[model samples]
Target chain A: MAHVVGPEVVKYACTCGLLKSISSLYFCRYCCQLRCGFCVCHEVDSHFCGKCCENLPSSEARLKKNRCGNCYICPSCQQELSTRIGSKGPSNPEDPKSTPKKMYYLSCLYCRWSSRDVGIPDQSAATGGWPDRENVNANRLQEIIEMYKAMVLAEKQQKEKDKKKQRGKYLSYTDRTGVTAAALRKRIGLPVDIQHSLLKAKPKEPEPAIAKEDVEDLPEELLTKPVNLTEVTTIEQRLLQIDLQPTTVEKLFPVHKQLSIKRSLRCRSCEHNVSKPEYNPNSVKFKIQLFAYYHVPEIRIVTVEPLRAGRPSELIIKFTNPTQHQTTITILSLVLSGDENEVKEETGDQPSLPQEKQPPSLSSQPSSLLSLSSRQPSITIKPRPVSQEVNADVAIPSSKVILPPRDDAAEYDDSGDTHNIQDDPKLVVWRKSNKAFVKLLVTPKQGLALNTEIVAGFTMQHIYTNTIATTVENREPDKHDHNIRVFLTLGNLVGFD
Target chain B: MSRNSIKILQGALVCEESKLRGDITIGTGTIIHPSATILAEAGPIIIGDCCLIEEQVKIIHRLPFDQQDKENTPVLIIGSHNVFEVDCHVEAPKIGNYNVFESKSFVGNKVTVTNGCIIGAGCKVTQEQILKENVIIYGHDCHMREGLDRPGLQTLQMETLSKMLPNYHHIRKPNKKN
Candidate 1:
């Protein structure tokens, strides 16, 4: 038995107890709060067109330019954009009566401003975006040279420290041949006596250039003889430590992360929001209303066939929408039997059936019936009136409100069988929809327990929004451990369960 | 530890909780005060071993907030055998080895001071950031705690060390001072 309560009897409590709602309610999953629209603050970081929203990688979204390659910008203003809303306001800034089209806008790299202020009538804005533009600064080359020089100096200091030597001296052939006495003395800051000693020890001589004919003539006899030049060389070749010059100090800059924003729905009246205005979760429009009084529902298992040699069999469900309006119902997934577990093990040893060789049209599943038309036509059984069995078979009024399947529902399959429905073994059915009647009859697979969640009294939107709120509430740290066992029983579908 | 043998180089004041790992090169007469920490969490800290480290120089090596769990642990390893004068703070959880920390210098958290890095005295490095392979940083001469917590407004006076130091593995012209 149930009792009806007045609106005053219901205390105003948000999904999270931080706030109260008298008339309407809404829930935010990210923040885990039930905030009134007026209380929440919205911030838009980066505005992007529809194409980038669908194609661009998340890493690329953080860049200053939102447009990808194979797109061009507006020729007049050199801005990348896409035309979205059209013909909404006044045309000219000065003229009062002229009508205007609310057009798309893009940012300018040079000016750091958008091109929406000056109406450019960009035809390419509909199909094009920014392309690769050349950088004009020429001084960038000079800066790079200075950077390379500094790197060389740091490496030399590290080598000396690693060797653990007190007075290690290293030199190259370039240093011995190219360095002049005066320049070497000035660079190393050696004393005048040492500088003179270095010059005196070196032999001042340049080899004479021989003509091509002379080399050809002398090569036969003179090339065979080894000439001893050690006696003519007065100074011994010595290695000196090269004094590395330290680079000038340069400033560093801090790094920041970039964020991107997307718009789903726009308002026609005031462009203040420019995107989807979130609705109150408790409103009637937001709710899922079920009208079950007019139609009859049936679940027909059209086909059942074996897949692997000894594994669990595949079952196909053919649900017919006999009513005039299209019926939307939820399939609470399928379950397998314990007895079939032995058969599943033997099938694993054998190689999987080659599914790719089949034709494209028949590639979905080999076990299930082709479509609803291929199965038997609608068989309408006479409705049973007033009986205890009828009351038990059909669930009472106001049971469940179904919402559109969430996006992350695909992660429900831990195995890669999310797309293939033949993998499941057990199937559950709902007895009633929003307090509407439900009837189930003979089917091949039986002995399954059905959990009929009878939702007392709530709008369609409230139930769906509450379902989302409940999921977020369980994700809190303290409740997460307890929820994990419940979530595992429901499988990988984290959002709904 | 002879009084006349060790020289006091450049470094900042540090805390007592500091831990030093790997091969560290400290300049003569550098002072390392109490409470400053250093963890050669990664490879080694190869200071020129001759440079001075001042007192209270906090040099630490710990991972940054974003890359902590994803990447390897902080390694404060130095190789530049620089001097540590009195009151120098040095903390590098992950030091690669061979980097030099001047007196009165401060470094904390996953700061990879690779070989050949020269940190000036009185310099404070906070925020789990990267100092790359070969980089040079000059400390602000005035105060040790100026502009420490201002987000996005921090002025980091750093330059590419490659421009000043030679590539450790490459065959190129060495620094004139070496």
Candidate 2:
């Protein structure tokens, strides 16, 4: 019988194949390979002070003359020098604070000798905390200003050139350009000298207008024929009553796209990079920084339905999760406001009907496997007030559910999978708790029609209570009455109906 | 705007040939000039309120930086009663009053000179550097660069002055005029 043995399989072909933990793998800086410390050449960059790294913001770091403002490069070995607290060790004993307490890796690019071997002291190491440079000279300062001025002048000249080029493209649109030029000059408050140059009369050009037949003609069906939306209208009519049911009105349209990670390589000499290198392919063990927008699942319902009897109506929302995973949800109070509807309905307004979407049914598994949990964990959240007004849609996952993976998905273990979809249909159940009463009364006028023209738009929880006079003769019952209540489910909510 | 006028874009004052009051201290290297008005109505113009203002050489506080947006308005605080000599300009300080300005001083944009400090003649303070209270500055444009590349050559002259006047301290008293 032919031996069915695989050709001499390597036992420890990359610790990746072995049963070893991730920590055992050593990162190689130069080769960008992950070895078990035995496979590849490991080179260390400059050692930086831990304290400085923690304190400095990224913006400030980029502005520094050196790539690192606090950490210094070792002039002798080209290796990073480690900073140590207290006097003693390889630093000046006279200056007690200048010493290396811990051993950090450094590489000599020329010799390929790591800091582990040659004990050469790096000059870039912070021996005395901070260095004092001499004061700036007045002449150099003036030169910097002059250079900045020249750069600004060059930028202005380039903008002018671009404007002239744009003008060349549409020479026949001289009248429009004249108007735009006048408007721009007025808006920017340009002085008289520039205005004179701008408003100078130029020769006008007349161009032949294209006939209707010259333009690209569309199909007759696409042009004047109307779409037969009877099916949509009937479905919309059937669902109109369901919209009247009280529910949370928080709705948002999320433009969902895949969260992908891109890796790039950066050179120490020039802070710029040629291409993004793969993180997994590189043996460089960089500190992974993860930023996430963690939300506390909550729902809100806003309505304009006036409460005449000094009583608030209850809001009822139903959400169904199609996925088998159990999720958490929270209910939040809603803000209600009143406003007039000024949007006029177009004659051929074929209200787009929503396609019948199926609810995700739960598996036949026992309910004992899942339990209710808080949407937000009991962690203190310090609300950092943003200086500007922001319109942001935050997805608040339940404490039980997981947050979705971001672009840099490798950084975080976002195990919650349901959140990555538009309809992870959650069943949110809540009751209206506000007791604020609002009153609306319509008084008639002499010159107007017998009945006042009243229109109303409502959401899932909001009910339109517009007073209608029975005297209006030419009103269609289906069109004049409130047609539908819109149900909006936000990403942050658990269940929505 | 002209280059010189552009320099005054970020809340700078030019005394425009005026006198400054006393008891105000300014940050190091502020510039104020002639053809400026600094009238501290109520509070003294205290430079270096937040250490952001640079070069309060001959600056005065006729109006506050915030209140300068008001139309046809005269500011109440010309902090520290600070005065400027020829080519001395006055702009509003951050907060706190006390003016102490002296002759031929040129304060730059965004300069802060605190209360109880005196600025002396021909001084040109450019960038944002603090001048503490009771800090007395003397000489012309004390800020001078000390490097190999001296493009403008004016920095070299300033450096010479810095060397000539070696003794510098927060509490150093002004040397008597020769």
Candidate 3:
């Protein structure tokens, strides 16, 4: 969360080979891998009007062309228009007791544009009854769609008739009688046209569009009249109408407000939702959010000395364990080539190794059968090699740094250190509840020009405790070390002091 | 040049907490709310009938930069049925009938507001220009557009405030007799 303000100094490599901050990555529990936005599948969960907060179903939204029915935006400024009431004076001047009639018109309170400005009459009712323009070519388009539907239906029926002819080859009762089905039907006193009547009527083919050689020439008035920019509509304004793109400002009409959508992300491999928002557009809460910041430890750069070419610089980085379990951190050398070997092993060994390792009794258990039937087979995508260039070498520390579990009560208590834990004083500079600062020595590569950005890389291996119980017998938490490649962009090299 | 002169005609209701200074004349059937200020720095201010000035409104009549040294000073006259909404600041030299200065609106001294004009809420009009009849200035960008009809009067709101304000606050007595 500290990286939300400034430039990204620390980046973690996702399983899909994209480098991103911890706040932007999602950790999938089923796959046990970090997923980025590029690798996950995104789907629109709901469509809602941003102004009215009214949610619309997908089918109804499609019917309205994905625009709100009641809301409208100003054609000039694109702001929401409010309906205002205008009172008309008495129609009969001699009638003293007559009351004024109220009429409503859509007006933009922001831009002061009203429906009356475009010569539109006011409406008696508030909601709806506004004039809606239809496309001039709508009838032609409808004819084309109906023609295509009929053509497809005719093609399908012809294919079925061909299949029926092929099936009648082995059954030769008609051939033995030296008569076809139509002749046998006639001899049996049934109607010869019964088959045609039984099938549905076939539609006639529609006329195709005709291309004419004569094109309309440019208007003669363009040569005499001076162009006014305000009267002519811009490209953006014309595109807003989409179907009827008016070129003049007077022809512009109020546009229906477009609907916004809420999206949900799913892990591609396991098909589990990584993030799913609530159905209600007003509710800001999420049903399931597997953010990597909640599952993995976060790393941030605390301080770094001025980096010079080929000179060693002291860099202090802070690591916070966000989990409830005590974790151990071990620093390893950055390996750019080892990822290819690991990917080869994963694809080559996964299929045969699972079948040979399971015992007969273990596979026959009722719980195992239940789990096997419920779980879908995962399709693991091949991991790409890390593409970071390490221009500086980091001295990997040998001792592992241990971080205590986070405590809610320890934050309030002002008492000094109570737990006695041994630590490597040289490597660990400072320690607090669930957080530790580690010291590292980085040496930039020599022969680099001045002002070149120095970027260092490393491998962070941390022990993760999986508390999820996959089987009835194994209730204990599984402790395993997970590795993530981290890269830090140290500031540009300064002149030698 | 008396600095604290205020003239309230018959049937005008001016709250005691309202700050008035320098040759200001309020017409009949006008209502001035508490904490509203009217200052005539270089000239006199004559407000017409049936006007409603709400709380925290400031109306100042100061001379322009070119006309500061003239012996004959022009008076800032605001016509009848005009509503000055809450927290508006009006420094316009002239405002005609049926004009509305909406809440938190600022009208600089350089602009002249004509009849049936509306300066919308939170609109700041500082450019030196003249607003034509029935012109509406609104939005964050100060967009100007011609309106078809003038805004309605707030007689009901004026009646309610006039009845309620006299009970709890002091009032300035009318000086002009009929």
Candidate 4:
């Protein structure tokens, strides 16, 4: 099962108009809509070292520039470097009783790059104490960043002063108090004007970089000497040391391994988490996973006859109800124009889905009001029209096929079929506990060239039972007919037989 | 040609599990780990002193195709203090002292390794060329660079393995005294 590759024969349309397979789509239970990766918001959940699997906090990771402290990568090949011990001979060759001293150096097992290759001295201990090189222009860059931050703060303060002056024209606080702020400051024996003093003590500005007209010429050796490509570093090697892109291979230094991140996805409209991974980096379990495969009806291509141009082909697709509730599947015609209108209406009706807050009851306590006031309004994204085009026509089935609820025990008890339910012989070819194979006649459009790819689309309407208990008095589950657009890529068209 | 053809000099440790074939002369103070293969297909192989050959290392001395018909079979001489790391395939015609062949590094018979050279792990040197002294071959592209100093010797590991291997595995008796 792990080796089985999925052939993208069926695709479901996402709410954001992106077509994706069911395995890639997520069903947001709060919004009760399908969301693809494009429509969801992704956030980094954790930062971890890929080599050691040590989880680092975001603050510590940021301080270390998002690199593992203990792990070092090869300067030449960027592979992980292992610590190797080298034994040095005794100081005096005549002293046969003396033991050799052990020295450790970082070495890459893959690329054979060792600290000794670049003239780096070996350390007495194994784990750390390797010297780290500081960027040459770090102090200059830090000063520039500080200067920009002060300048932006000064501009923001000026904007606020202008706004205050504008508001003062309507009603001045000095006029209402019958005294100016200067008088109050004078009475308190403080500085009369605070703005002037504060402005005079502004942060020092950094010197701007000046571009010179005269550029340095190329070295004399470059014109005379034959270039050795092996001695020069490639562009990729230079970029590995971002600060100083060394052109020569001698300047290469071991880089700290960068930390990896785990991501969590959230539905944009409902502000609900669609997928949230566990905090532990080693654990692959997720806290919340609302995949479409667990909520929507999965459709797989069973068999399809050879599609000929302008000829009808028998396309059999198996549909399985993944939800616990029994559902009735209705196959509707591919109404492109009608779907556009329905999407527009749903976008317009999204605001009305959230129920209005009821008036405060007479017996309500003050704490309840605090909770109600803290609730934030959910943001909804406008739905877009699906962009898929149907090239082949599907003959809609008149009768609706009903699927039973999934039962785990029924899989083990594979005795002769019981609880018989009559099904349409022409529509449903086979039926099991919760799976049904339906047959459809698909006709390729005429005038299509030979070997042209044929695509057929249909609207699948299934009964969805929302098990969420609302504030209403009734405890009954809310059942509504949900419609989804499904597209099937039939085989290429064949020439006339 | 025969099991007795292996010539182990004095103080050399040759494990019984090591596969030695044809006329092979192991120098003094050398340590041959178990499972290391030293095959002399066309001629004799003379390995120098203080060399460490680890497990799964293959050192084959086969004549080149163009030189196979020559009446004189040149001896493949590996210099002193050369280290053959685990799982490395070395078929170079000549190797100098203080050269380290890292794990899984393949040195074809067409190449010649000089003194103080280090072959990066998994590097394949098939181009017919001679590597200069203190030349280091590293990275995916087999980038070459000259080292400032020679790599440190594995004297401690050799000493430990020499004492430990003789206790667990059968050792070939040295054919010549020091």
Candidate 5:
């Protein structure tokens, strides 16, 4: 647990070839592979305010520009402002029954900044109605937006007309013969018109802004007065009020707090959600979380002997089984990314994958499930190759360790191991209810310099007991071997004594 | 340097477990918690009224190395309504009213603190300069800003701590009468 602040000694290579801690990696039960944030598709599930926890619909969020209307942050320090109650003295000094009026003003506790500094008047009641400054350029901006909308609408109509012309099987009344429209009008005994309504219709473009050459010169007072840093607002304070980046302190205003969103991650291969958060903003639980820490055997480096080049050193690591099913763990030789062609081919160039792997036949799933959640096809990002180098060699033991099922009551039950399970004395150093410490030998390469960091890698194969009911008929859950690449970063080599 | 002379005026609550050495004067209604150290190596410290010195705070009055042989003993005078939060080290020569030295903050001997000044948590002020009134040094970048008013007083916190600390800890009696 100290590794939260200390160095990360153990890292698991994601199926996408990125090395991440097991806690950050997710296990897709349907795909039966480890997925990381890089490989998973992250989508916004809901938007909510961090302070008030008020959820906003996507349309409303877009309308409000993704900022919480009620909550404001201090422009000076970026901390949330607290509304302070100030009491004005009773209107009548002689009347004892009169209550003093309460006025509310936003104040920053950290920097002691308040709305009064910028000359904003205090409100009588708290929630809102503090005057919002109208944007000076709002009208012009609205006109420009309307002009663009009209132009785009006209373009779309022209495109549709062209499409209709292309769809026509025969020539039209004008295009078929060599007769002009003016001649046709004369033949019909009517006055010939010069312009056609459709031909003359066009959207008027707005006048473009012209570049000015003149620049304002510095004021004469700048030479005589000492520069006061306090009067001028810092870059951060100015940027907080994005629309109007005020240069002076008096122009600084409180900014509305931006909204936060919950994200749902889906696996690309099987198109199943790997992690989905609960909709409620206050609840910390997740609706569906297939984290690898719950499914895979977590490895932690316990201790390692001081390193010397070409000398064998003992390295002890602890493994914990988080699931309820007993599983067997085996250590195998590491296979680099390029060497595994089958794994690479399936994950990459999968745009037209007709037959999805791992899930019970895709046709067997309900049709409504597919139509209800149909969305635009997600773009697949290819994983990069693992770039970590292994400087040390690990002695892969032939024996396998059997981890017992996790029992909550066994924590208090002092009566130790009644179950008869065979253990390798050389490998198993210590064993608890569901945890075991395994020992191994590591040898750094001979050419390594002093103080060079040693890295050892291996592939771990564990029997994963799937608990998901894949089918109604098959009562027994499937058991399969899941392979994971484990890399350990041993400390720097001290010397070659 | 080994002399232990402490003068706690009336209404001042100075804990007996606090490490007080040399000549130190606590003003009326000032509260000093247990394990707070005030070492007067080169001079006496005069703490003013209603100041709060929390646990693990170290206020040392050691002069610079070059001025060790000077004849005059420099007096470290702290002003009223100040707050020295947990683990703050103040070696500053002068302190003014309504200033706050937040937790884990350090003030070097060269810097002078003034009224309504706040040294943010974990901020270190080692530069030699006089702090302006209401100047707040905040964040890891040590951003500076002038506040409109002094930060709210810790009257409620001090009232609760005063009532709570004596129940569990030993209090040093005030010998000096106001």
Candidate 6:
């Protein structure tokens, strides 16, 4: 429940200043920075129908205007319409053995809306041949489109002719209109101007559309008859047919369900996909998942004492190491003012690579860049300073807490403590496999009002083990101290009786 | 509350363990589970034919607050083909034919239920309103939708329950001969 529907008491500050739960954040291994949905580039991976789960190619999806061809939704209720079979009387009633012909029609189970209500004929076959509504002004619209195409082509040819004129060593009079060149040739006693029979004729141009002042009068029956709301279409029902927007229920028709797309999120800075789903829609698996819950240490508030003004309260927080490698966590004072950051300092100190946040060093940079050449260059959003105000001051412990790597076998075993390790009695309250509960003292700001919300923040530095080999010689994983600012909403302050 | 008077008609299958109070009449082809409770507080509860009263179902025949002072005893008449699912509480004044009270649902005394209505699972409806035929009350918000046809009857489920129930538990013999 805490992983899904639990209240977000602990929030980790993302690179974009927004505080999000660790479950929603992505940890980019290359940049070693936490990225949220706001600071990532989302690209569509595939398009598929939600109902049929039939995957459509990008080109085919574009041709169908991103709507599923086979499946349709009810115009009234916006639910998927199922094909129901209707029995029609056999034409050959004289024969006793003939079975009744079956016809298929669309019907909505929830609302009991049938296609016959809108005068749609039942189809003999199931899949295709449903009549598409022809636009009333199709011919006129076609003429207008043709006229614009010709006009644009004519303008392009004229521009090319002007460029040729600039390159001419000797200017000719015929270049002005072509009539001047032909008339000049006729005046010079040239035999009737030999002409190329295959020359194209002048492009056709249609008349411009004119606005009409006349409007259709309202129907007389609307004023006389009592209107039934159910008979009239609702706003949502009308909006389903974006182009038509039919007002009457009679005009409503079944709409093809819109296609859903599977999107892959890429880290804005390093151009690496943080999360990518499997190609099949049915598979609930991911190809690459860099969720912060999996990579970073998950901090959960176990319990906190009653908060009072200027009083030190005991706060116990449990930290779970989800990664395969063991890491040490040190509680640091949160630097709310972004004047100095630990990430920038770590990059500056490294003598091998001077570039900051660019982890694809000499070994793995070239191939990744080549594959992403077709995609647009992702814009690097600037990191914003953490905005959460720490109203309560936390007593930072000098001692670092070490957590064991996650083990699947240890989770099932209910036996007593197998690995005995020395822990600081003052800070570490409890310890188990890959998890440790640490104690901290928190004091609300002095002269705080009664029942004021107390928010406390602290910077946690954990050594992150990068398993990705940056060089050929690097067989052992390189560990770097990654800093994450976590804020806890420790409820409202209470008054001392 | 009066002394228990349960009248089981012909072809009715009622478990002996069921709690029946104050002049309750169960009609033909009805199946009553062992743990169902039917309380007739102010009047007699006349349940019609082919009604399924599952376990933990409470059917109370108590009058509403406004109508409680009146001396006239209103007979709570449940029409034919009604289903009272497990853990549902029904105190409706009138229930027409082919109505389904789903599991854990509560139908207050003020709501008048007509024919072919379905009160969805876990839905609590207390407001005074008449439910029309083929009306379905569903979801957390109790959204209403009018279905074109009545919800299909649970004939197959009732048949299975009737055959399987007699094997496991003691059934009350139908007392009414005619």
Once fitted onto the true fold, the runs of candidate 2 whose alpha carbons sit more than 4 angstroms away are: A1-497, B1-58, B61-178
* lDDT per residue as tens, model 3, A151-177: 666776789877753332123221232
lDDT by residue (tens digit), candidate 5, A41-66: 87777778998998776555665789
Chain B of candidate 6 vs. true chain B, TM: 0.98
> What is candidate 2's lDDT per residue for A1-497, written digit by digit as tens?
01221121101112112211222333222111123333222222222233243222222222232245444333222234444322227546577667555433433222122332333333344433332333245355545544555555556567987775333311221123233444455568875223333332331222334567577767687568875331122222233223232121111011111112223332211112223322331234434211000111111233323221212222322222211222322322211221112011111111221111100011111342342122111222121211221111122323222222222342353453333323222422221111111121211122332222322112212111112122245242111111112112211211112
What fraction of native interface contacts does model 2 preserve? Answer: 0.00
Q: What share of the reference contacts survives in each candidate? A: 0.00, 0.00, 0.42, 0.53, 0.47, 0.05
For candidate 6, the TM-score of chain A alone relative to the native chain A: 0.81
Instruction: Put down candidate 2 lDDT per residue, B1-178, tens digits, no spaces.
Output: 0111111222223233423443333333223433333334433443432122223333444443565576553322333233344454544344233333445565554566555544555656645655554444443324221111111113353344334333331222222221
Scored by CA lDDT, what does every candidate get?
A: 0.31, 0.30, 0.80, 0.80, 0.82, 0.82
Where does candidate 6 stray beyond 4 Å? A1-5, A84-229, A246-252, A339-377, A418-420, B17-19, B54-56, B84-88, B102-105, B120-124, B138-145
- lDDT per residue (tens digit) for residues A1-497 in model 1: 01221222222223222222222333332222233333333333223333333333323442334444433333212233333443446767689877774555343322122333233343334443423233343245334433444444445456767886464222222233334454466578975332333433233333433567444354564578775331121111110100211121111110111223432221111111222322221222312212111122222333433222212333333333323332344432121121132122112211232332111222222444545233221221121211111101111223322222232433464453222222111332321212212222212222222342111111111211112222323542211000000000110111112
- Per-residue lDDT of A28-132 in model 6, one digit per residue for the tens? 887787889998888777788999998776655755789999999988778899998888887468986788888899987655577877889999988746777
Residue ranges of candidate 1 with Cα displaced over 4 Å: A1-261, A266-497, B1-12, B20-25, B28-46, B49-77, B81-178
Rank the candidate models, highest DockQ first.
5, 4, 3, 6, 1, 2
How many collisions per candidate?
166, 102, 0, 0, 0, 0
Error (Å) of candidate 1 at residue A131 is: 13
lDDT by residue (tens digit), candidate 5, B40-107: 88899999999999999999998777778989899999999999999999999999999999999999
- The weakest ten consecutive residues by lDDT in model 6 chain A span A169-178
lDDT tens per residue, model 4, A1-497: 21231677788888777788888889876556788998887777778888888877665576578999989898777888888988888746799778877889888765566888777889988887998998999989877766665676677678987775333212321223333344555568775433333454465677878899999998999999999775787787898899989888778888899998877887665456799888777988899999888788989889999888778899999999999999999998865544543354335343334332111121132445564332222344566666777789999999999988777887887694575778999999998888999999999998888898889999898887766665446477667676778999887888876
Best by TM-score: 5
When summed lDDT is taken over every stretch of 10 residues in candidate 1 chain B, the lowest stretch is: B146-155
Candidate 2 docking classification:
incorrect
Candidate 3 accuracy as lDDT: 0.80
Alpha carbon RMSD to native, model 6: 10.5
Ranking by TM-score: 5, 6, 4, 3, 1, 2
Q: Compute the lDDT for candidate 5.
A: 0.82
